[model samples]
Target: MTFKHALMAATLAALVGNAFAAEDRMPPIPADKLSDAQKKSIELLSEGAPAGGAPRNVGAGPWVPLLRSPELLNRLQRMGSYLRYESAFDPRLSEFVILLTARDWSNQYEWLAHQKLALKAGVTPAVTQAIAEGRRPTGMTADEEMVYDFIDELLRNRSVSDPTYARIKDRFGERGVIDLIAINGYYSMLAAVLNVAQSPLPGGAPQQIPTLPR
Candidate 1:
């Protein structure tokens, strides 16, 4: 390449690198700059296994930006605690719902964070791969397929059909059905926030979900 062309390319690469480095617009507030409410929120967030375990540091993932609205964060985290840990669905199913929401929103951070949990919770690699690729996963258990179909329809149509709703309700009971929907909705909201903030994965980890064509 010509000298001028090489220099231009070098500058372009630097800009891209900086963009990735600074992708998380809501970087953590320094301790000194934290407001009283923000400080209190940190305590509440760190107090328990909300979302199965609070972040070791309050500055991670959705928590970083969420810390800005301390009361909201506190409330949301409590709700998440119940939904994630106390909900009727099994861990595998919970993570599966979360992954579905993440993919539906194309929220890379959520997918990156939960895909492992889903697998560890026993969601099959083949199932996750299919979800990641926007295809219907094959070989899911009868229960997994039921949950998948219910969530898939809900996300796509913004409403579940009577038959779909009845199928889930009959298998899991009303509480189970609600818990399933709640998990999907909760993650969907988080995904929206993360996507709007363009939240970056921790430690500059590479983004896994490709941006869909507009």
Candidate 2:
């Protein structure tokens, strides 16, 4: 296939939606057929997807699939839902960890999405701006403080220190701590994928993230 043809195929594959397996593609979704929310989602993703014009080689294989694959996507989305229902940390805390992971891996697109969500989740505008700028949030709540500290430990040590883990264990009890680790690890893998893919950020995406320390 010509380069242009290949790029078209990739974009169409994404635009087609993968709410399930890519093999079991979504039926043709007409613009007019979509509800307002669904239509807006389609429009945003369509506008932001990479051009696919010149694919780059990274690591041993491709990276975007790990982000878009239905099985993994379902599993990961469940983590967000579970957090929303069962945890001390709110979605804003989740967003804080996501921003930390994205900044750590230099993944611009990840930062963009989570920053927007963090704000919507009631994270203060100043904190989102701070996170986007790669600085600490000015005053994260108690739960956010726990999450940020845990993430800082995880990235630095690749595992939380006994002290930090013990704190989370006490704060969240056993299951919550485990879920916290699972959630952070999930985002860590995601950040690595976006970094490896060199995922393109949306146009008008914030370009102001600070440079994380090496």
Candidate 3:
């Protein structure tokens, strides 16, 4: 299948997985809540996700699976998978982008999920810990610092300075930089959804998001 289609399928799987998991124990709203916009958005989100742009869902607290509906879920699944399945950038760079944003945002779930992925991506433990803690890791090798610095620059400015941009260009070439940016943007969207939804870290136990100076 095509890249977009594959991504949508993944989200569809997550949504379908949860479809039968509800009961009357579902949380009460006291009085019916949700503005009309939110209700419609939620419905659209579930109908199938699109190919990138906005999060699949961004409601506060618990939510019906946004991808439960085949249409919306399929659209988002495509976007999520397409962004994640790039081939030009070194996969390690993708993980670094994810780790950097997760750390910058002080998002516990994002950090927790990416930490292992970072390590598996060949990032050292010290560097992974530093990234997870929002500390500028002095742990990178000279060659490796280029990627870390690129992520750090983006986290700081939400855009790159000329010198950093030049270095990234030299190292990763144009496609790599674009992929890196997309990687960060993709995770940023995820962090927003996870935070607003109050989704805990992947496992059931609660963990605190690290405090950042902002």
Q: 6 in model 1: Cα distance from truth in Å? A: 32
Residue 61, candidate 1: Cα error in Å is: 0.7
TM-score of predicted model 3? 0.63
Please give the RMSD to the true structure for each candidate, in Å.
7.1, 13.9, 13.0
State the TM-score for model 1. Answer: 0.86
Q: What is each predicted model's overall lDDT from 0 to 1?
A: 0.82, 0.57, 0.59
| Candidate number of the best TM-score | 1
Worst 10 residues of 1 by lDDT: 205-214
The clash numbers for all candidates, in the given order, read 0, 1, 15
Ranking by TM-score: 1, 3, 2
Estimated TM-score for each candidate = 0.86, 0.59, 0.63
Better candidate number, 2 or 3, judged by lDDT: 3
Q: Model 3, residue 75: what's the lDDT?
A: 54
Q: How far out, in Å, is residue 56 in model 3?
A: 15
